[model samples]
Target chain A: MVDLNVFTTTTIYASVLALLSLGITLIYMTTRVFNFAHPRLSLVAAYAAATFMAIYARSAHLKPNLEPAETSIGYVTVPFPASFYLVGVVAATVFGVVAALVEYYAILKPLLRRGADYLKLMIATLAYDFILMAVLFLYNTHRAVKSALSNPLRLTPTSLSMTAYDVSIVTEGGTFIAGMFIFSAALAVALAAALYLLLYRTTLGVKMRASIENPPLAEVLGINVERIYAIAWILSGATAGLAGYIMLFATSAGSLKPISATSPADEIVVSAFAGSIVGGVNSIFGSIAGGLLIGYAETYVTQLLQAITGYPEMFQYARVVSMAIVALTLLFAPSGLAGLLRSPRARRLLSRIPVPGRARGGGR
Target chain B: MEEPIIVVDKVNAGYEKLQTLFDVSLEIPRGKITVIVGPNGAGKSTLLKTLFGLTKVYSGRITFEGRDITRLPPHERAKLGMAFIFQLNNVFAELTVKENLRLAGHDLPASVLEERIREVFETFPRLRERLDQKAGTMSGGERQMLAMAIGMIRKPKVFLIDEPTAGLAPKLAREVLENVRKLNEQGYTIVLVEQNVKAGLEIGDKGVLVVSGRIAFDGPAAELLARKDLAKMYLGIS
Candidate 1:
């Protein structure tokens, strides 16, 4: 019998990781830069959600009586409104977009104009990661001082979590799934679908593909490559932000048992990069698969290793597992699983799937 | 002749550290084909790229129809009725032929774009047959034709074509040259860089021979074509 808890937890982790990997893939495809600061974008978003939730919690606070209760009564802790969570996601998304634009206009654009080498550009993004991480830390410290709320660095957003309504079933041995798990998973699916439509069916999508194919020609054809790049950045940032907000819930609800943000986004980022590489950075769908594969592996492998070795601390080797996956993927299949699907046989197989706008007999 | 449509006045340009064009100037007469010919290290291609605002102009002025466009970006120049077709990677390879045409006519209204696309399809029937085929899959000659068709869709005042016949069969090369002549007949001022000196000079109204980052001769195409001494001395042709 499979552990239902581990399965659900893996699904939740994979869902948010898929979102983050998609964001990573989007920015890489358009700009030809691997943004090391991408994980920080999510952290900023999580902070934004946390900030909004803290504000709401403060507003809804009930001042405790200085005198002791006659029977030592316990005051009830009410959950924040569902609308507050939505507002938090929105706030996080906006902040993510703004941060991405600032990084583009203020740092990345100047480096590109100066014809900085790829290594220099990469280092610049690393610097940006630390800079933004410092900003998140400072903001966390500031919030702790300004409102007397829980410390962000020490306490996860679980301290201000919305109540989870579980849906229990009387089937087989009795099944149970938390409402938050379903909600976050649905959001991930919707985001991926929206991205697919935007990339394949719209005028902006055509422009984006043209620019990605050949930037100079696209520019000559009057596609406004700069604007397309800006759009890519915004989309990447927004997706990263939304993923971060969802991750807070996933972690708080204990649905992503394998991962949680303790200090910053270092661990989640490692898994995301590993997943992106395994999925093939060029294909959005591939990233989703890669993320899920890593998500499941991280959870199950750690459990199996711990059970076999009788070492409770064996879960710490999960990062090692991700590193190994990345190395093996690069060595054996440099193009990733998506690259394999690009083969003639795989393409022919896919062609039979009856997708719209993909009529056969066209030249490759 | 009828006030040159684009005038390059003593331009010095290059890419990054190395200078490629030194004090070169030329005038492109309206609705006429001007061919640039030179030996292998001459600044022929650079001259065309510089006029289209692709290279870094260290010092000089480029005036298009009496408007100073030296400082304009490539797309801005493209908007102002100038089209550049490179020797390689001229079209969006990943896109289908129809998508490529649509993208070229991005500024046009949908109805107008459809009409213009139909016009291009009529001009190049082979492209019409392969409308849904990706551009990258086309043969070299067909790709060149598609490149020209994309330029035509833009309806530019001047066309800057570089090495249109560099990597084509003799028959296809001649066919491309004939299309260039046909385009000129339709009243497009053209700036062409070609390695096929005889055919290029025969079709051009004016010719500028560049050598070692300088223009060695600028005059009637027939005269430069006939001058064996100038041809052998600077153009590396008998």
Candidate 2:
């Protein structure tokens, strides 16, 4: 008997992680920058959503329902209007895009023009992440001060989770799934499909792919490679922002606990990095698969180890599974799952391993 | 006879602070192939890149059709009736052949691009057969043909081709050179850099020899080929 709750939770986490991984992979492909600040983009989105929801609830004169309803499995004490969440999503996405553009135009673009190498650019992104962290901390402190001075519903921007507002749907089998799970899963599929269409069906997509493969040639062919890169950054930021919003509700931690400005992002960066690397950093679709695999493995492997060891404390080391997966992937499949599938030699090697349903001489 | 299609007036250009071409000057005549031959590291490709606005020009003027274009970027030069084909990694290797052709004429009107692609197919029928194949999967000779075909899709007035036969077999090299001649015959001015000095000069209308970043000889191709002294001393054409 599989636990429906665990399945839903894992699905939500996988979807959000997939979005984050895609953002990282897209930015890397276009600019060749590791973008250490990418995880922070989601943090910005989460804060934006928190602030929007708080402001909207106050304006609408809705009482803050900080406690979960009896029927709900997760959070969402108040019956806030759907428009509140919509505004939050839009705000998060816009802020995400703005932060990404600032990183590119203000930092990466100037350094690139000055002929900075990959190492310098990566370090620059790391510096930008620290700067962003400080900015977010200041913003959080400001919000805290304002919330203390304000009237009724105590909503601090530093501590926010959409799960407090989420509704749960009970199934016929006496189980339930959070609405956030459905929303995150649906959004992931929609975004992936949209990206595929944009990259393969449209002329702009062809130009972008061309620029990614060969910028000099694309430039000589009269394509504005810089403009293409800017567009990619915008897309990457949007994905990160939306994923952050989704993550706010998807997380299963204490509803009332205050999360630090950086803690949520800090917790997920390794998993996101693992996903991108396991997918073969160069392949966007591969990153999505990698993210899902890592997300599931981190959860299920931890659960299995705890069950086997008969120790509940083993769950505290769940990230160790992700770390181990990253290490093993780097050692055995450095090119990633996509690269292995693409290479004839790798495919031949994989065929000889006699996996179930494996075809012989399938190398193309 | 007519004003040369492109005039490099004592141009000093190179990568950032490297200065590969030193006060070199040359003119590319209209409707003919001008071959640039030089020893290794003699800046033959740099000269071509300079003409295409790929390098930093320290000083001097480059006039294309009487318009000074010393500071224009590569894409702007491409828009102003110039096509540059690189020696390596010239095509979008991951893109399909059809996608490559479409991207080459990216700014063209749909009907015009379709017509141009058709004409390109007529010139290189092999590309038509491999329309769905990735450019990287093609043979070296086929890739060269596709590079030339991509240039043709633009219908530019001048083509700047760098070592189109750099790593090809002897037979394929000759075939590639023959295609360059055919492109010239179609009234497109060509500036080519070649390692095969004798074969390059054999197909060229004018030969410009460079040694240590300076032009050692610039004259009719047959005249340069006939000079046994200059050939043996610089080009190892004894």
Candidate 3:
């Protein structure tokens, strides 16, 4: 039997998944275009961190003790913890902005001007998805792994769940999977709130909403719909990129093999997709909820499959269970948990179907 | 007068070579109710889109407020104080009526926006009651009202309403018309395209009839409405 602590762990994992899922949904609602490459943006963020850390490890300017020499690979490099992470964050943020522009200039801007429907724009995204995956895999391949942490995260191990990715430089702490998850979760909440404020409280956000809601009408009223779409893409993608970096710390994310090489991030992409679609694929919160729900399900079912069948190979079951749940959710609740929560009748019916830890409210 | 708020000079436009508007030229007076009445497919909406920068202008220039805004984007024109309400109900169905109005404010300062909202609520009290209700749930009349409120919230230099009374009961249509008149009287210029010939001519300062992508008739509203040919052929009286 799985311990109660395991369920708690699953809930935590689900919350982390919710972050990127929310981004996907937010971008979708605003532009009415699915950025299938959103998960890849997260991958980009992870690599950004890794690359920054890699460079910081051994710069003669940063650390005079380390002699910069040419290695068999090419350039001799030392890892610096402090500088690398900073560079990674900046790089990832920049990449996110660039990605948004690419989307705007290449697909959305033109499609929007032409008045393309949401579904048609999605086709372009599907194509862009493959191209992004290929490019990210190619880019990540240029890096080498380092076990020595010159600069590391400054947080409690319990808070971050530090992994032993590096033992040589023990003084510098690496943020463990747990830390990454927590950081990402906090960031997601902050981001969602900020975005809500921007859209609902600010004029720029309203302009964006107006443009999306009624383009021809808004244009007549002298609102710059094109500018709104462009800005929305850039800001939204930056978050997606940050989420990518968080995914790396939590798991073996950002491993891509090009030209017949397989990438581990491909697998992570599956869960992210499930989270997005499960959450109605249209709402930002729905995506986040979908992510966390799937994350917990994955962690929960994997344990069950392992315990009952004595199977160490339970990854497939985790995915399958998540998929099954997703399918049921789709069929029963196309609007997702949000939709169900919206209707009083549905809430009443759901209260009748009891689940543990769920309080049966009066359904008022 | 006042350099004509909007001027479309010799413009040709089409939908992929299937020409919709041809060599159309017109001037809209500031703060006046200009109505374009025509039979179906007379390119009334097309001309509006051309003027609003929604369609391609093959030959002539469209100027708004003395600026050659022919090639300017629709949203840019909105920034220049122009608003268009489509023939179909164009309110954000998923949003509340108030939410839709707020979106129209488009970066207005918070205090000013709040004041504007209050004033608009006073103007269209029906919207006040359903501020939080989703626009989709409202009746056809209500949806049109929401759209009109969205347009009026910005207090644009010129507002083009396509078939304003479309899909409404006679009572509701008259009510919507009254709202348009009230707004026009408040110093907002309006360009209305309507099917109700008698009522349109009676209210509008001038009536322009578009025929086969060209202006077939243009004159005072009463003069056009009084013509037997326009009444029988354009008004579909048979």
Candidate 4:
């Protein structure tokens, strides 16, 4: 019997990971900056989305379905409104764009103007990541304390209002999954298609490609290189935020309750980085494909290990499989798997075979 | 002689405190090709860079059509009817020929961009056949043509090209020089930096020969070509 649950879960994870890798690829390609703060930006968006969900619940005057345990302050719960998911996503995306633009203009731009080397800029991103992580911890603690939940960890909230919401869908094949799983996966594919069209079919997209390939040439050709970088940051951040919101909604059922304030960032960034590097850091499609490959491999490897050991605890080390993928890809394929497809040998093979009818060159 | 389209006067510049040009100056006449020929390490490329504001100009004045633009950035200079085609990495290697042309004519309206692309294709007819092909995959001669086509799409009044015919076969070199002369016929001021002394001077109206970062000679191209002594002394050409 095939386990449809593993397949569904793998797709969910792949969609989230791919969304994240796309942002990473875009930021790295245009600015050549390894943004450690990328995942932190997603965390911030997740919190912002949760907060909007809370606000929407309050404004609608909904009452909690389940009463909370007695605490210093009474349990304040608002029944979940499933449609508010859209509001949360929009809010998260907006918040992400604002944060990214601020970082670019206020921090990154100044450093670039001061002639900071790439190494310094990369270190600066690491420092900024720490600062954002601290902020997230503080925000999570604040929310927990105000809601009368125990805040002993002083990190992410102990439990979120989303725990009370249940949004699973039942299929005829006895497969169970959240409605959001489908929505998020569709959203990820749609975003990829949109990006492809923007890159190939628009004038601004052509200029962006030009800027990436050669900034000096683009500048002399009348392209505003700084402006292009700024736009790239905005797009990357917004995509990250959307990914975070979707992940939160899918996992928490239209709400967010991070296991730990700092852990969310580390997990997302690590997975996305592995995916991007394995796929091809420079190519958006490659990163997405990498994400999906890692997702499926991780799930299968864990299942195989558990079947062998007959111990569910073995599944905890599934992340080691992702690490292995990263290490192997870096060692054998420095340019990533996409590079192999674009290698000269592949091109030669592709070019050698002619069509069944007509002559070569195809009348072009 | 035509009025100066661009003048670099008393310019002292270099890269990061290593001064490569010492009080270098030249007048690029309108509608004429001015070739700057020099031996290796004679700062021929530096002079062109100084004019484009790519070098650190410690002190000097660059007037373009009578406007002082010494401290202007390269993009601003380009916007002011000036275009530069670098000696290397001049084209976006990953972009297709049509995409490269679109980027060069980014400032034009969609309708005007199509017309400009058509003009470039007419000038470099070979490029039209490879509109969808990546520039990096093109042959050396074809890449040179694509590079020149990129600069031409801008329709600049003054074009600063460095080593346009470098690393090409003899026939291709002559063909590139022919294209440069044809561009000059269209009333564009050209400042060419070249190693091929005979070919560059043959088509040029004026020439500046630099040796050891200083102008050893600046005069009519015919005079410089006729003076074999100056050629052997500075340009190392017979």
Give per-residue CA lDDT, model 3, range B1-238, as digits (tens): 3678998888898765578988898989888888998888889888877878777777888898889998887877887788899888488777777778777785677788888888888888888888778888899888887887888777788988888897788998998888889889889999999888677778898789998999988777778878887779877754
Tens digit per residue, CA lDDT, model 2, B84-194: 999999888998898999999999999999999999998888888888788999999999999999999999999999999998999999999999999998999999999
For model 4, the local distance difference test gives 0.78
Q: Chain A TM-score per candidate?
A: 0.83, 0.87, 0.70, 0.84
- Winner by lDDT between candidate 4 and candidate 2: 2
- In TM-score terms, which candidate is top? 2
Candidate 1 local lDDT, A139-207, one digit each (tens): 655645335445322234323332231222222344545445666678777876887898778888888
Worst 10 residues of 1 chain A by lDDT: A68-77
Give the Å error, residue A322, model 3: 2.8
Residues A25-59, candidate 4: write the lDDT tens digits: 88889878888888778777877776766666566
TM-score of chain A of 4: 0.84
Question: On DockQ, who's better, 1 or 4?
Answer: 1
Docking class of 3: medium
Encode model 3's per-residue lDDT on A1-364: one tens digit a residue: 6453354345445654676666676677667776666666655555555555445544524432233334443333233344544575677677766776786688766886687888888887766767776775555443232222233333121112123222112112321223343455577677768878987777776676667667666666666666766676777677666755554444432221211112334555577777887887766667777887788778766777787899888755677877788788878888787776668997678768868754533222
Flag regions of model 4 displaced more than 4 Å.
A62-83, A143-167, A171-175, A250-259, A309-311, A344-364, B16-19, B56-59, B68-73, B211-216, B226-230
TM-score between candidate 3 and the true structure:
0.81
TM-score of chain B of 4: 0.97
Best by the DockQ measure:
1
> What fraction of the true Cα-Cα contacts (under 8 Å, chains A to B) does candidate 4 also have?
0.55
RMSD of each: 5.1, 4.3, 7.8, 5.7
